[model samples]
Target: MNQYIDIVLRSVTIYFFILIALRIFGKKELSQLNTADVILILLISNSVQNAMVGANTSLISGIIAAFALFCINYIFKKVMLKSSFIKKLVQDKPEILIHNGITYYKTLARLGITSDELEEAIREHGLEHYNEVKLAMFEIDGNISIISGNEYLKQTHFKKKIIHKNLAGKK
Candidate 1:
């Protein structure tokens, strides 16, 4: 096989692998990452570099690999937009955490959210309590979106929740 072709194939494979890994691992918080998350990303990229480009440490090889990633990412996004099944398979649906000021304890527990975090998000939206919220949704992109029932704060508030791992008693 030609070296450039080999590089493209390898890079594409790595891209899909990483995508599936992230989906399976439930890494929803792309906007807010902790220190360990950042370190893991750096390490994963460094580790995958050799897998994608192999021993060809040349400038052209690196560019080819990058180009392959960009092309695949573009095509993937297009397909996802057009195919609901693919979109659902690749991403999680938005979770409703509260409705009519009623908190869904089960939903919060399932999404690894704590009451304190939810309260903080509510406060950010100028609400004193969850009862003040008309609707609270854990958005697909890892944002806590709050719609307050308060007549003064009718606008929706979107806040990124810091991803927490192994919060005591949450398995």
Candidate 2:
């Protein structure tokens, strides 16, 4: 019984710890998982597995810990949905990268996004140049969405691979 309580406590602590860590790391980290990010996630899971299970290696103990994690996650999500304050704390607001063909350099620099990356996102959206983009946003999900002022150049919301050479030539 005592060991089970310890497992639950450890699991809960680790869960909150990770949640806070992710929040502190910013939303960009969640947008795309690079090679290092994948390895880090794997290593974190492996390291915390033992901490959650402890010495009890029993199936029941493992199940209990897993159940606790799921329950906590579900409850957290529900609370976040209902409470704007909690939601704001747990998630990032969308960032405007460009508006009316003017780039927000300060916002981009603060978000650690380079001009090159922004240009790449613009190109990926099939826009020939930044001037063609009326609005560009770094969404909370880590995707850059572009809205073109040119009606003819507008495209559906999707992540398309940027082709270096089109009929018009390289952008």
Candidate 3:
């Protein structure tokens, strides 16, 4: 009976430590997740095994940890809502990766993104060359949003406008 109790205590402590450490590490936004972030998660999980459980986490403790995590996350979001500083800290702000068809090399360097990576990201939007893009930004969620050249917009907008105009006439 005493051994079982000691085991339960150890399991709960490990669960608490892993949960709190992850929350406090402050990689709140997906955009902040880089190679380093992934590696950190892998290492954390590896190190926390003995602390969390022996074979698998027991049902009751898992439920308790889930509830604790959810409550802590709820509190964090509420706090962020009330505090602009916290919001900025948690959410990655949109930053321009390109302006006027020119890549912002310095900004890319600061963000640890290379021009090659930018080109690759833009490729998803069918951009064949850098000059084809008018503006590009790395979104808060780590998505690459690219605005194509003016001619591209003009052609695309014309089609959309024509479709809308035709729909209006039908109405």
Candidate 4:
């Protein structure tokens, strides 16, 4: 096979594999970037670099591989926008975490979100208690969006706090 064609095929394969892997691992990984998450992303890119370019280390080969990746990514996004089924397959739907101040335990468990995390999200929205939340959703982007029941106390922006140490004094 032509080296350029080989590069294109390899790039496309790697792209699809990473996409499926991210989807299977859950969307939460995409939303929050802790130290480990950042390291993992860097390592993944390094590891896949050789797989995409193979034994060809020439500057042209590398450029071709990169161009192929960008092309496919653009095409994929366009297809996703035009096709609802493709969009649904590629993106996660928003999940209701709380409704009318009632926490959906099942949904929380399924999403691997603990109560403490939910409480923190609630507090970040300026709500003192879960009952003060009118609606809370785990958005497709991995953010927990909260709607307060008290119209007067509604908050439009939430600031997420970075905790260096836990309650047990462990990092």
RMSD of each predicted structure: 9.1, 5.8, 9.2, 5.9
Which residue pairs show collisions in model 2? none
Best by lDDT: 4
| Better by TM-score, candidate 3 or 1 | 1
Score candidate 4 by TM-score against the native: 0.88
Residue 18, candidate 2: how far off, in angstroms? Answer: 0.9
Question: How do the residues 1-171 of candidate 3 rate in per-residue lDDT, one tens digit apiece?
Answer: 454454556555765576456445432334447688789778876776545444546776555445645665687679989999988755668889888788888888777676777877777676778888888988766667888875645322111234676578785
Query: What is the Cα-based lDDT of residue 138 in candidate 3?
Result: 81
**Candidates' TM-scores?**
0.86, 0.85, 0.61, 0.88
Write candidate 1's Cα lDDT for 1-171 as tens digits. 999999999999999999999887774546558898999999999999999999999999999999999999999999999999999999999999999989999988877788988897888887898788898988888878888887786645556787567675586
What do the candidate models score in CA lDDT, each in turn?
A: 0.88, 0.87, 0.66, 0.93
Better of 1 and 2 by TM-score: 1
Model 4 lDDT tens row, 1-171: 998999999999999999999999999999877899999999999999999999998999999999999999999999998999999998999999999989999999999998998998898888889898999999999999999989898576676667655554754
Candidate 1 has its poorest 10 consecutive residues by lDDT at: 154-163
RMSD (CA, angstroms), candidate 1: 9.1
lDDT of 2 by residue, 1-171 (tens): 698889888899999999999988877777767899999999999999999989888999899899889988999999998999999988889999999889999999998898988988888778878888899999888888999998887565556576655544734
Descending-TM-score candidate ranking: 4, 1, 2, 3
